[model samples]
Target: MPPGDAYDAVIVGGGHNGLVAAAYLARAGRSVLVLERRDQVGGAAVSSRPFPGVDVRLSRYSYLVSLLPPVIVRDLGLRLTLAKRAVSSYTPVVRAGRPTGLLVHRAEPERTRASFARLTGSDREYAAWRRFYGMTGRLARRVFPTLTEPLPTRAALRAEVADGAAWEALVERPLGEAIEAAFADDLVRGVVLTDALIGTFTHAHDPALRQNRCFLYHVIGGGTGDWDVPVGGMGALTDALALAARQAGAYLATGRTATAIATDGSSAEVTYRDAVGEHTAGARQVLVNASPDRLAELLGEPVPRPAAEGAQLKVNMVLRRLPRLRDPAADPREAFAGTFHVAEGYRELDLAHRQAAAGRCPKAPPSEIYCHSLTDPTILGSEAAGQGLHTLTLFGLHTPARLFAADHDAVKAELLSATLARLDAHLAEPIADCLAVDAEGRPCVEAKSPVDLERELWLPGGSIFHGDLVFPWAEEEPGESGPERWGVATGHPNVLLCGAGAVRGGGVSGVAGHNAAMAALGR
Candidate 1:
């Protein structure tokens, strides 16, 4: 390549990580070009009007983002408007007079625990809830960085060595066991454990699944780990990142899909096709924002060994009015801005998992519903415009795509109907009645199973974590390579692995992008 024409780096996929990597690299004085397959730059972190006047936040696969480090937010001066409203959750338990449900919100821990103690009458269990989340917050801060770097620095290494035992105890234990050790109430256990297994297919009894819970604990809300949305919607954060990336001197193209990555030892050649025609660029370094499996598909054959197995993700929604519970006395506030878990109890949740494993969507699926409109009213425009419709994101993981028939209409209706049925079980009326609208965001919701998310996101084996978050994978060395062992550095002269699909596993955190840029530019 001609010296004048060579770029220091070319980032593929204009997702947040790609934009972030471009910004960091350019800031470090590297000539950077960002190539996006889609016309829009946000990838999954985008908002588009699928229907007129219906602005849907197409958080495609991800809806929450507290895992994103504050450092990137500050360094890029990314101003984010988080939903100030607190998270509310309710689990219904019917009594003679009326149905009662446990409600938790922005309250003093003492008060929250007192409520729990009243319900379960276990002081020890209440204390455990407080301490567990407190520890989870601390642990997220400590472990989040591990997935970013190719290897830890001397300072980091020394710290890890010092805290080795504590780390093991925290990450290695089964999330269910960990919860059991901490809380006695089955209801409390069900709530806490449900989150641990949120985006994962793992049951509560599954080992290392608790680590997922630990990760989730940090992803939603901080402080005591409450879940919140951006003031306008989650898309606000992505918009800020894109604005920052453009300000830092990076080009963005939407709707242009990347076709192949040709690496010739020293540099990478990125080939993409858009409406115009095929275009290719040569860069000193290359970063991918796609899932590992998607990357492999784009590259075609001779696939790179995957870092993660990939995650199965599903979203169901269309809302006319907000879902009303069967119990009229239930707190309306708790029904909004918070997550609703239909798992009910451990046994039911476990059964749902079994059904999912059997290549069928569970009858009463274990769901985590997040009503975005209630929390961020700005998304719906002005109240004078009309009653803002609510959008609920239901995540189902571990189920393979085969559950749905290849027919698009059949599969969509099936999943949609099934999801509503589960909600109706608890609510007196069908949740679907509230629907002023509904839509499926899964790229191929009808034909493809949730497991197809692995291929769709282009990560290996559909492992969302890119691989297990176990020791070696979490603390990968610079030149290492193996199953569950991270080798974020491609060992090529300029290519750097920059997505959670690389080696750090998955999350909304931007460390993968930051570290990749640092490595490419020798920062």
Candidate 2:
């Protein structure tokens, strides 16, 4: 806790990735310290009781886990539990003026097959769906393991994948070609495309291929492409990492704002401010667990590149009961268990993107909804659980930060209302009816626009992935530096990026931090 102290390594932020780096470095017998600007660690990967006096702790920012490698969890002895949802997703649609839905079961193939047959009137689309994911599944198993190790070159990864057809379809060409060729149904195609557009604002055929990178990251998680719920909300995962780091003798300080970092390639000095005043800490290396833009500022240099403007709306709500679905055959519990697609038909998605890109909120905003409480009710306290309370999270896509620049508050309110209306269209009962009041007797609902995220969480453009994601592999032959091969390299040898902006970094995964620590130890 002493000012002007020196350590072997100093981390600039105490997010999950920073905590991971601290745990690994300290356990390796390196003197380590983590400085966090926030009072509590975890950054956006945190849980909160947003409602006044509420006992429920919603994973307020990052909701699910998919990209975290099993190796890091084992290496750190993380006390975390990730629960898989039985139903993968349910997309409700209106056909011939009759309401229906398509359900994808996580484990039961027959049920899923039957559901697909019922919706499409044939087994063709279902078979195509399997074959499509089959390609991704093969690639996922081949690629995910290399995340924490030295970054493989593009040629090395492609040669290892060995499936030219898959590599060409998923990696070489735009994702739209695969989506169009694999599925006939519009809604089904849209469901498949959702994975590619979660936090990134791009169409399937984006020439830059940002969507492909997003799709690659989404499907390569855990090698099964399954997005699992963090038991007790996201806070549980970060808390475990914090505990592991502390147990390994890493010093973590909150409310420590790192103002500057100066490194001469072998050693570094970090200047930061706390309540009292500015202080300096010297270290052999500095691992920055913040956006590249933020890191560039601290180093008195121009940003490497702009972090993409995060383009989506995050809404959190507490409901007394699950809202009834319009479809008679679909169970509300099952429908809400996994991702519930809304206003997300293939055409709808494209249309929404066009609307947003043209500088307007979509009249029918595309969004996805899921009830976290259905999979893990432990996030709710005894009173709320006994009272049948549930938490619903809605992620509104194609709602870019640009829309809020004119009038932030007004635009956010309008988008929230439009998004809710879009949800109500698929429900037999209005979502408002199922709302629960917090201790203050106000509706237990809150919404965050891209601007809000930028203000509150410091997300560049409110982009959840921090910026447009780069490929997991190195673009060219890596430099001689150890961190370059690990995808955490910076211009300075003694400084590395260990946050979402790092190559192969994003989501709730600790891969960046682990890679940075490995890079530091090796360097």
Candidate 3:
């Protein structure tokens, strides 16, 4: 506690990965310190009471989390309750000359196929549709492990390639091409294609693009579906992580912003400026939670260059009401559980990315929406006496928030309006009345929701993922510099990267931080 006192390690961010790294290191008998810029932690996986008596997620950015390893949660003793289904998506189908709309729950493949057959009956190939999913799940389970850590060595890579023949087959084939080759039914193709587009930066039928397949890797990890909510809120995950770190004797400080990292060839020190004064902490090792590029700014031209440009943008809305489906049964508290997807087919999805890429919002922007209140009643259950409230998070692709040319208030209002307008187009009633409050309720909303916030918040390129997963970049060779390779470890001796930008991409996966600790500990 003395001035300039040294610890074994200093973790830069309080996001889950940073906290997890602290817990692992502290438990290993190493002295660790965690510094967070915000008063509270959790990063994107945080929850808050923004509106009066209504608990809403600040970003609620990520809905389902299957890719999170059980070992980390179990080791941390995190009490995570999987929602009924990971996620459920709905696409409205208009019957020709019927003047009626059918909302299809696209999460359940068989049920979706049946529903699709109702419209494209003669063309649905149920068998091939089943085969595609089965094969995809198998392939994802195989390839997913490779992404968790630095790229495997040559021998490891060869073994993985041998073990991943199924994934290779799926990856080699374009999703639409695979569907056409595998199934005779157009409806089956549409459903599979739609699933491929959710949360991805790619078009639905874009051949050779595997972002959806990468997305599937996360979805399958969910165990049952595409999304899951903690018993209380996403913040619970952060709470659990902090609890783990605290239990292990790590020191945590909020409102401590890291300004620069100085390495004297053998050790690293974090320099910070705070309300009281500027200070420095000496440590044998340092772990940074900001993205690789941002870390470069702090450290000045380290290994990894500007990290992978982030591909997607997210918006979180605390809705007054759950989204109304064109039909009521869309609420499959049972059939298909957690998350919801908005866009429908390959062509429609293609147009979305086209607009986003062109710096314009898509006319019918595709969103993956999650209404946590429906699954985890705890959020609403506690405030029964207060106001009826629900929170919905929509993840979409856009030109960065800073690019909006509007001020924060105007941009926030426009985003809220745009999201609500899209929801109204898909549902029955206008959601304006359901609004108990908006993003303005949470101060971090601007920080977490906008890409510009990333740079301002100290994450390079607003990337939550440390880097892109493009090949060769992901290939790990000794002395390589990319995040997919070196990760949180600074080729610079004792320095380490811990946050989402460190490596293994983002999304609450602690691999980069965890591995960096292990490497620093030389375990």
Candidate 4:
């Protein structure tokens, strides 16, 4: 905590990735110092009771854990539990003026197939779905383990996958073409494409293949692509990481905003500002856990223009009770347990994308809802649990940061209303009627747009992945393959990216953090 004190490594952010790096380095007996601007660590991965007087702790920003490597947990000895959700997803669609839905059961294949058959009127689409995902399952098993290790070349990874058709569909060609070729039903196609568009602003057929990269990260998590709910909320993982880092003799300084970082490739100095004044500390190496643009700013370099824009609306609500579904046969408990798709049909998603691209909110914005309390009631505590209160976190897609540029608050309010209205269509009762009131008698629902996230979390353009995702492996450069490649290295040898902006980074995964630690250790 003293000014001018030196350490083995000084991490410039206290996000989950920074904590991961700190834990690993400190456990290796290297002195580590983690500088955090916020009052605490964990960045977006933290639990909070946003609603006043609500005892329930919600995963405020990042909800689920998918890409966190098991080795990081086991090696750090983190005391965390990620409970799998029973239901995979329940997508409701009106068929022949009757309320119907397609439910993908997590453990029951027969039930999932039956739901698909009922929706599509045959087993053809389900079989195709199985074939497409089965390919990714193989890819996940092959490529996921390499994340924590040194980076591999594109050729090396492609050869590892060993499936030309699967590689071409996911890596070479546009993802939309593959989705069209595989699925017949528009609704079913949309469900598959949702994974490609989470927190990404792009069409399925994007020439840049941004969505393809997003899709790869989504399905390759934990080698199974299953997004599990953190048992005590998202904070549990970060809290354990912080504890491990501290136990290993890392110096964690909160409320310290990193102002500038000056590195001479081998040695570095991190200048940070606290309430008292500015202070500088020397380090053998400096790891940045903020956005890439933010790192550029601290190094007195020009920030990148056309920053990646986050394209999702986050809404958190405490409901007094679960709303009745339009479908009488479907249980509200089951439908709300997994991802509940709202206005996310394949064609509808494309339409929304086009509309948003033209500077207008889609008439029916695509969104998905997750009822976390249904799976983990411990977050509700004894009182909220007894009152039967539940939590619903809605993530609305295709409403980019541009829409809120002119009229930030107005657009946010308008989009929130439209999104909730779309969800209301599938419910027998209005969600408004089920909302829990805060202490001041106000509705407990709160919504955040891209602008809000940028302001609060310092996410450049509100892009959740910190920026556009990159392929996990190193692209084939003319003879550049070595152990020094962790995808976290910067222009300066001592500077490395440990945040979501790293090559193998995105989501709540600690892959980038682990890779940075390994690279720092020269392993």
Candidate 5:
């Protein structure tokens, strides 16, 4: 902890990515130090018992894991366990003034087909759904393995897929155009497009095709892109990473904020602040696991900011029991076990995006909910489960950061009220009625806006991806070598970016961290 201590590598921002990098570097026999500003090291992936007198530990910010690679899991020997949901999604759609549900079962294709038939009155849409996901599944298999290796050129990537038509439909065309052409029903189309829009605010047909990049990452994760729940909540994963890093001889210092980073000809320096005083550390190389904007600020340089804006409202609630669905035939346990879409049909999502872009909240906010407790009851323990307690995590789309820039508190309240009302539309009773009260008798609900995310997690503009997602592979160039092909390299010789802001970065995937370590190792 001395001011002039030197290490082989120094990592700023001890989020999961930073920890991953630290673990890998330390395991390679390099002296590593990780400095985290927060009291805890998890960043957004931490789990906490927010409600008083409640024994529930909720995955506060980032809930599901779809991107953490198995290679990283095996490399670190992490003890984290991920549980898959039996139901992929259960969206409630109103038919003839009576609510009906569209259940996408992971294990039972026939059941999913039946649900689609009942809702759309046809099996054609279900067949299309299979074909579309099948294409993504193939792409996932071809692409996911290459992530840990050096980046490939776009042409090389396409050649690997070997399916020109499928690539053109998914990678070249606008995702919105493809979705519309593939499905006839609005409900099914919305469900497919939702993957593209999560934490991203963009139209399906955006010529820039930002949504396409987002969608690609969503489905290509884990080779099949199934979002699994952490058995002990997200904290368990972070804790395991931290443990791995520490056991590998990496020095992790919490409550220490890196204020500035400067590089000389051969080495780098990191100036940080702690409770007692300021200190400076030296390293042969520096790995930045922070947002690009934050990195620029630390380096005292100006860089064109990415078109990054977080457009979602996150609300975490511990309910006494699952809310009853309006559909009489649907079981609340089954429906809430997977993602529950609320007012998120194709037309509704498009309208919400248009309204938000025009600087107005949609009349009916579109959102998706998940019951984490249903998948992993261990989060609540026997005391809470005996009382029939559950957790409902709702993510409201089209609630952009700009909307809350002027009056953050007031706008957040208004957005939360509207979002809950939208969810209540499909429920037989108000969601508030199933609330679990704290010792103070307050409702067990906590809502976070983009501003809150920016303030707490240092996510620039509250963008969960750190920036607009870019195509994973490198663009073709005349001459590029190993380090040049990697996305983690900064302009500085000894400085690297290992955060979500890097290309092929986002989600809970530690690919950036892995890439950064390999770059530093001259691989």
Candidate 6:
């Protein structure tokens, strides 16, 4: 940890991606140094006890793991465990003052089909659902492996997809058009569309095709897109990565903020601030695991900012007991175990998007909730579990960045109230009633706005994806290298991106980190 120490490579952030890059490079016998600004290294992937004196540990920011390639897990020999949910999703539909809902059972397709029939009034919608996902499943298998290897050209990727109908439905047309055409019921259509809108603020019919990119990433993870909960929370995964990197001879230094990065053709210089003072480190190459906007600022360059506004509200709460659903036939445990959709029907989602786009909070906010303790109770220790405590994480959609720009506190409170009211509509009892109070007697409810995410996580515009998602394939330009190259390339020869801003980068996947290391190695 001495000043003027030269290394083979220097990583600017110690998030999962940066750690992954450092592990790979150092394992290959490169002297790598990872500089992390925060005291801890997991970035948004860490778990912590949010409520004071509460034994419950919640996955504070990024919750699930789906996009992480299995190859990286096997290659790194990580001991991370992910548990699958029994149910895929359940969407509540209120009719005639009664609770009727559609449940997509992961283990029991028959039950799911029955629920679909009861809610949509036919078996045809279930058949269509199978067909649509079947195509995506095939597309996922064909395309996901290519993500870690090299970027394929747009034409090459289309040839790999190899289905004209799928190409037209998923790639050519807006996602809304495809969903509407495929499903008969509005609720079913909305359920299908929710995957495309996660963290992305665009509508189903957005001409820019941002939703299409989002949908593609959501469905293609490990060729199945099953978002599984970490056994001991997300921190377990990153902690393992950090250990692997250190074991591979990577130097990990926390509380070091990278201030600037200057690169020439062959080498790079990184200026950073530690507790003591400013210092400089030299490396043959630099891997930046920060947002594109942050990187631009570090390099003292001006670039047009992408439309990367995050448009969701995250609320994490610990409940004393499970709330009862209005549906008499539905089991509350099964319904809450998976994704529970509230007021997220097609029309409701559309209206919320329109309202948020017009700078007003929707009257009826759309959201989805899931109980993590149902899948893995280990997060709630013996003490909390003995008290019948469970963790509920709610993600409210269409609560865009612009709404919180002027008055973040006011907008966050207003949005949380509206969103909770929307959830209460489907519950037999108010959600607030099933509360677990902290030592101070405050309700165990914490909400994070986009502004808060920006301030804490260094996410530009609070975007979880880093920027507007690009098409996962390569766009070949004149005088450029072959399409089969890593997407982590930067303007400088010795600098690359190892974060969410890289192409084919989003979610908790370490593909960007792996690709950045491979690019650095000239593989």
Question: What is the C-alpha lDDT profile of model 1 across 1-523, one tens digit per residue?
Answer: 2123357787878877887888887767677777776557765566644443455543555666655666787888888866644645666655455555556665445556665665675677667766776666655555555544455543464375455433444555566666677777666777776665654556777654534543443433332355557665556777888888778876666666778887776787888777878878887678777765566665664555533443344563546666667767565546656777665466667777788677666776666677777776566655412754666677654443445436634654676666657667777677656655423422212222344554454435555555554332433244433211334455454556677655443566676677667666654
Query: Highest lDDT, which number?
Result: 2
Q: Tell me the TM-score of model 5.
A: 0.98
Q: Candidate 2 lDDT, tens digit per residue, 275-382?
A: 999999999999999888888889999876655698888999999999888999999999999999999999999999999999988999999989999999999999
Candidate 5 residue lDDT tens string, 209-240: 88899899999988998999999899999999
Ten-residue region with minimum lDDT total, candidate 1 = 439-448
lDDT of 3 by residue, 1-523 (tens): 3234688888888887888888889989999888888888766667766555444544354554655766777777776665554334444444554312222344556565665456555434544555666666554555555544555654465465464544454454555556567765433355556555443356545564655444454544533324455677777777888888998999988888888998975788898766787789889888887776667777877557534444444655555545455554455343223444455444556676687677666666555556666667676545542555666666655334433544645554565556557666656566565555543553223213445545445544555455543331233465543332545555466777676644454566666667676666665
Error of 4 at 368 (Å): 0.6
Q: What TM-scores do the predictions have?
A: 0.84, 0.99, 0.83, 0.98, 0.98, 0.98
Q: Report lDDT (CA) for all predictions.
A: 0.60, 0.92, 0.59, 0.91, 0.90, 0.89
Looking at candidate 2, the ten consecutive residues that score lowest on lDDT are 302-311
Total colliding residue pairs, candidate 1: 38
The runs of at least 3 residues in candidate 3 whose Cα sits more than 4 Å from the true structure, single-residue gaps closed, are 1-4, 53-60, 97-113, 122-125, 144-158, 161-165, 169-200, 204-213, 220-226, 302-313, 328-337, 385-388, 398-416, 437-449, 455-457, 470-487
Give lDDT: candidate 4, residue 370: 91
Model 6: lDDT to the true structure: 0.89
Q: Residue 250's C-alpha lDDT in candidate 5? A: 92
Positional deviation of residue 87's Cα in model 2 after best superposition, in angstroms: 0.4
Candidate 6 lDDT by residue in tens digits, 1-523 = 5434898999999999999999999999999999999999988898899898789989998988999999999989998999999999988888766788999999999998999888877899999999999989888888899989878888888898899788888988998888988887888989999999989998999999989999999999888978899898888888999999999999999999999999886888999999999989999999999888888888889854655688889999999999998888788899999999988889888999999999999899888999999999999989999999999999888988999978889889999999998888888999999979998899999998888888988888888888888878876731243112788877777888899999888899999999999988877
The candidate with the higher lDDT, 2 or 5, is: 2
Clashing pairs in 6: none
